[model samples]
Target: MTTALLAIDVGGSTSRATLVDHAGNCLGQGRNRGGNPGSNPPDLANAAIVAAVEAAIADAALPGLTIELALLAMAGPKFKAVQDQLETALKALGLTGPVVFTGDLQAMVASVTAATNGYCIVCGTGAGAVRLRDNELDAVIDAAGWLLGDAGSGYWLGHQAARAVTADLEGRGEKTALTSAILGDMGIELNDDRLPDGRPVPYRHFVDTIYAMRPIELARFAPMVIANRTDPVAARLLAQAEDYLVQDFSMVFDRELAGPVVLGGGIVAHLSGLQSRISEIMRGAGQVPDIRLVQDGSVGAVVLALRSAKVTVDEAMVQSVITSIAAHGLRARA
Candidate 1:
């Protein structure tokens, strides 16, 4: 009988679980929809977590494999409140060992390195930064949801783009490609409505369309902004986003800024243009930035689980786990 470790990473957009052995060999992987209780209802979050864990256990198909530990890196702020319920759920699935709960950022930073102290920045639908000391959160920067902050987040970029397009439509701002690009993507035509003077005033329609949905849905337009980055309006927004992100890193340090800065989230991880701009800006500030990008936090969850089980791990071991997960067709989203 082989003893296995169960590691789960719960994010706002997706939840993932992986089963691994002592040697970092991936036995199975499972995925489910967004499970962030902070962003989603508690019932939905718990269901997603349980479903992902169950799928991973079933996929392992190891008859005598006993899960010795289960570690969940969750995005919810009040995870401890539900830890007992989550543990009971895991136990129902045959987990015998203790279940541990950790912050999503902790798993994210650990995915790429063995260093226990550094910083982490997440720039997906929302943006935030954290300082980690001894693998625990020491300080935070700008994680204050969409209304309060999240300056460089996807929602921020999309909201800025929409505002610029509205300004352009109402003849209040400079004309740019974003006007047509955004309207086209949203299936809103300029002639969708008209003014009293019979002018093609699409701004009304656009405003109504935007205000009709949940604010977070604005992040869906972020890709359009990135796609039209060469446009002056889009370029300016992207630059501002880069500036905000770099500022986030700076504010978290509040001293000398340095490396092992692990970055996650769609904007920072997938946008090569923004990544280069950030590096260039950080260099200009006289800091050698060692920014590592992790697609999601699953691998870091695995690393944490292994360490908790008294298994020695290094960068090489992490890489091995990455490769093994890939070999098992458990690759993270690109």
Candidate 2:
């Protein structure tokens, strides 16, 4: 009967569970739809969580394998209820270990960097920044959600693109590729405003309709801006996002800012053009920290759980787990 460690990364779009042994060896992995309550309804979030965990347990296929410890990286409100629901799900999967829940940002930072003192910038469906000392949160910035801040986030870009497109249609803003891209993505005709009766719909009608969509749905428009990075409006918005993130990092660090800077989420992790741009900007600003991308966030849960279990894990062990995960791909299915 092998004892296993369970690591779960709960995100706005999906949840993944990874099972590993004491030697940092991958056992099984499973994935399902988004489970974070901040980005999903409670029922949907819980269901996704259960489905993913069940899949991982099934993949492990070890009847006597017991989860020694588990770490859940999650974001949402009404946490007590969420915890209860998560606990029930874990029990159903026969994982009775004590589970530790942490903010997704904290888990992300821990996953990539080896330093205890550093910062994390997440550019996902919603964006935010966090500072960590000794692997715990020290400060937070712009995680105020889409309605308030998250200045350089995907939601921000998508919402701003919609606003700009509408303004352009109303003769209030400069033209940009976003106009056609957004309309195309939404399946709205360029002449959607003009009825067969010849009366044009108000620009507000377009804006309102788009607003009626879900947050993650609207975030779909963000990549269009990135796709048109050379367009003036898109370039300017990207610069704004970059500047906003840099400024947020500046606020969290000292005048002599130098430490591990872990970059996670879609924008930095996937967009090489933007990643190079951001790196160039930071280099020019003379605030270069040790930057690294998360190979697999589930590895963070494993590392953290191992540490909590009083296992002495060095940087080599951490890097090995990351390497193994990447080699196996994100969902180490077998």
Candidate 3:
């Protein structure tokens, strides 16, 4: 019997679905809007999940494919109400197999490293870190959401950038390039009497331009700040962001733990400066272990699925799956 694997990672602003064969070969990948019920409406979240799953199935074009394992890695609190509703939605999409729902930490721990015990940090649209012990989520440190946490997340940085630009515009803070960069990014002009589109201006008329954007969209300016990091204001912002990340990393990391410290999420994984700074800090704390950046998390979910299926998870096998799934996901996005 040919068994298939279904992996879904649901975040605050986006959800991705990937289907793979028992052999760890990529089948199809689908992406949809935010599906976290805690962030979006319950109905909207459920619809996003079904849409992504169905799209992935259609893309695979594998008729009669029966998924043996399905996992949903979700953000926010795993309320029972949300889980029941999500499971109902999955069942409606024809997934009736053994389904599991994991918190954001469990998913990242599995995806970022092969180690059964270690630490994994995610700093994407939101931020948080989780400690893995014996391959289970042991302790989580403050990567929750923007309302109460997520100090180093994209949403947080974007929000900070907005505040900086606004302060400068209002003459309450020093001027910086971020004002023009943010205005340009939003298609608004700084110091303009009014919005060209008649929409409220960013700072002068209102913060409507920034307010109109989703958290993920605002995070796009993170790179802009990076580009202008030479400016004192931008450099200060980056410094603050890095400090928050280091503190978060320190919080979940047990110095004596025996596992690699894996880094995921856009801010930490892709940014070399941030990665180096975080590494230096870790070394100072004597918590250094293998530090690796994960390519794609959907591939990690497949590894866990393979484990549940009683397949051998070794170095070579894990590498092969990662490579294949990474390529497949790239093709999917392209």
User: Across residues 26-62, which tens digit of lDDT does each residue of candidate 2 receive?
Assistant: 7877899988777677788889988888888887788
Residue 283 CA error for candidate 2 (Å)? 8.1
Q: So what's the TM-score on candidate 2?
A: 0.86
Residue 78, candidate 1: how far off, in angstroms?
A: 2.3
Least well predicted 10-residue stretch by lDDT in candidate 1: 250-259
Candidate 1: which stretches are off by over 4 Å? 1-3, 64-66, 79-85, 166-174, 195-212, 254-259, 269-289, 330-334
Q: After superposition, how far is residue 61 of candidate 3 from its true place, in Å?
A: 0.7
Runs of candidate 2 exceeding 4 Å displacement:
76-78, 196-212, 255-258, 269-288, 330-334
lDDT of 3 by residue, 107-204 (tens): 66667556788878788777888888887888888866766788877777777888888888766889899888888877776654545664335574
lDDT of 1 by residue, 185-207 (tens): 88888655678965456887788
Q: Rate the local accuracy (lDDT) of all candidates.
A: 0.80, 0.75, 0.75
Sort by TM-score, best first: what order? 3, 2, 1
User: Which residue pairs collide in model 2, if any?
Assistant: 13-34, 14-34
Residue 214 accuracy (lDDT) in model 3: 53
Candidate of highest lDDT? 1
